[model samples]
Target: MFEQALGIFLMLAILSVLIVVHECGHFLVARLFGFQTPVFGVGLPFGPYISLGRKWNTEFRIYAFLLGGFVAIPELGDETNASNSSEAFGVELNPFKKFPIWQRALVAVAGVTFNAIFAYFLMVVMFFSVGRQVEQTYVSALDPSNPIAKQAGVLAGDDIVALDKHPVTSTHEVIAYLGNRKSTPVTLSLIRDGKPLDLVMTTSPKGKVGMVLGQKPAQYIKIDAGPVETLGLAGSELVDRTRLMVVGLAEMVQALTPDFGPAQPGAPPKPGFKNLHGVLAVVKIGAGMVQIDWRSMFMFTIMISMDLAIINLLPWPALDGGHLAFMLVEAIRGKPIEERAHGEMVKWGFLSLIALMVLVMVNDVSALMNGELDIKPEMKEKLKGR
Candidate 1:
């Protein structure tokens, strides 16, 4: 029990740091652009409670009741009182209100950008701390009954060059490209017998491109340059992995959309959507990762970071995307939305967000109790050995 509690606490701490860094991106950009951002918080609000006066003027005061480590930019474009008529009328620059629509939009997007950058940095650290591991390619032993390799006559040693014309340099890339493919035949370009060749490989209903490339451990240590080159390599690796994740997610979402051909009638029902997991889910996942191998832990961290970026960019209220949407509207209308209306929109957004969070929480709990969250026995044994 104590171990579980410690795991939960560790998870919360990691998540909190990630969230704070993301929000800080927004706060920093807002301040840089001359907006008066008064409060920076670390967690959801627990109501107006007196904060001990700290040396760094970290004393707490609550002006609004919604909890979440959030930043509050001063009300924009509201000058009802005579005392600040000039400021309201734009005689002086209203940092929040006076910015052009595009600038305001960037301030909102800064949070997601921060998440991406942080993920990249963390990825670099992981690479240096532990070198890359690649799985061996094994296409030779494919079942003769498999339609994909049979039609193409793809041999095991054929090095994959491209998938449907897209470059295939990495396993993650292979996963993303294959995820987008239908069961139909895909043209695979490969190098065989030291000659560039193309094959019309039919994919199986499972969507495999029908050829596997061999994998090996290829680690390069920059003993001379030490930290700098390692960091750069990690950054590049992060960008590569993040791109793959984003592409995979986009394909998944596309499949779920109603416009995508309805899942064949009577086909097994798709897994239910679990879109808005909140802090509790975050804690549980983090704890679970810590119990896994370093590779899994790092991969999960990157996945979570990507998830944060994608979700925050959706045009929903109380999200960066929401602010972006409003900024776009303001741009088109030639004026910012009324402060009251904006506030109401934010309130509604918060309510909807909370409702989604609750649903995800219930799903997480069910998934845990049902043993859905456990790693497979084989995988668990493998990781344990690692």
Candidate 2:
């Protein structure tokens, strides 16, 4: 019970910190460019709030709901509803705009830029503390009816030594090799029961052997990395993780179609409401990470930070990317979008986000009631191997 409470606190704290960091990026860049920043809020600018004094012609505020934060730079020209959105939210804009389009673009992108940087820094710290996780081709489960592997004598807990006589240490390597040669004969060199064994099998047309791969902490050997090497590794980690996330998001959208099919062998079941995590889901799973050690928290925080950055980069209404899209359209046509249309779109977008949040919460509640939200139970079994 205590672990669960601590996990909830940590998740909320991390979300608040990420939001503030993202907002700070915009606040700093706008101030640097001498923009008329009327308000810099620590929390979402809504409802009852307390003023935290004024500095540099800017009023700082803390709102009642502290889930996210925002900054208001009047010169950036989100002044569609000056009387309502601007004044009601303490974000009143001056009549005249001063900054050029390019400068506005920089200010708009700074939030995501800061998020990316923050993720990288976390990666560096994690690497320095516990080193990078090395992937191993360790077999955790096999299909009960896997005739070829069973006939050729493959067993659970075997270390996959190679695929087709090519030495391999990672499951990804074996997958890539098979994917390139579909429906082919394969030779697996494995180490089982402290003895080397060979297993030959014909893969499915999709190049699957019907085995589940899992790596525990005990199977990972960490290597000390130099500073320069760590920088390269950190940058590579960011790029790779971002690419995987983008692919996963695209797949999720595709799976929403009416004719969506089951995932390929060994792939996770297609994500939907049940697997789509939100605040409740994160807190539940985060409790498990908290109980494990600091390493889990580091990975979770880094990934969540990057996720926030990526989500903001999407060209959806009321997002930073949407503002950039508007600027782009203006750049092409030499005039900004119509004020009414912009205001309407932003209003609807904000509503849509709230709706999405509510839907996710409902799904989370259902999953919790079904006894599927807690991760601590599974962690007990998995951690024993580690």
Most lDDT-accurate candidate = 2
Runs of candidate 1 with Cα error greater than 4 angstroms are 1-5, 48-68, 76-97, 133-146, 151-175, 179-232, 255-268, 274-278, 381-386
- Residue 68 C-alpha lDDT in model 1: 46
Clash number by candidate, in order: 7, 0
Candidate 2 residue runs with Cα over 4 Å from true position: 79-86, 91-93, 135-137, 144-155, 160-203, 218-222, 260-271, 381-386
Question: Against the true structure, what is each candidate's TM-score?
Answer: 0.73, 0.82
> Model 1: per-residue lDDT, tens digit, 1-386?
67667767776666766777787887778767776554455556444443433322222333233224665454322112223433432233233355666667777888889888888777776666655433322243445555567566777767666777866665566655665676766777777778988888656666775455443323233334467886776776677766776776776676556555655765665544654345666777567656655455665676677778888898887888888888778878988787778777877888888887778778888777877666566445434422
Give the alpha-carbon lDDT of every model: 0.63, 0.75
Clashing pairs in 2: none
Local error of candidate 2 at residue 35 (angstroms)? 2.5
**Candidate 2 lDDT tens digits, 1-386:** 88677877988898888888899889899888887778788876668889998888788999988987888765676633444546565554556555689999999899999998998998887777676644457788887755555656667799887887876655656666666666788988888878888888888777777777765442223546778998898788767667667766766777665555555677755456555658778777776676765457776788888888889988877888888998999899999888788888878988888888888888889888887876655455443323
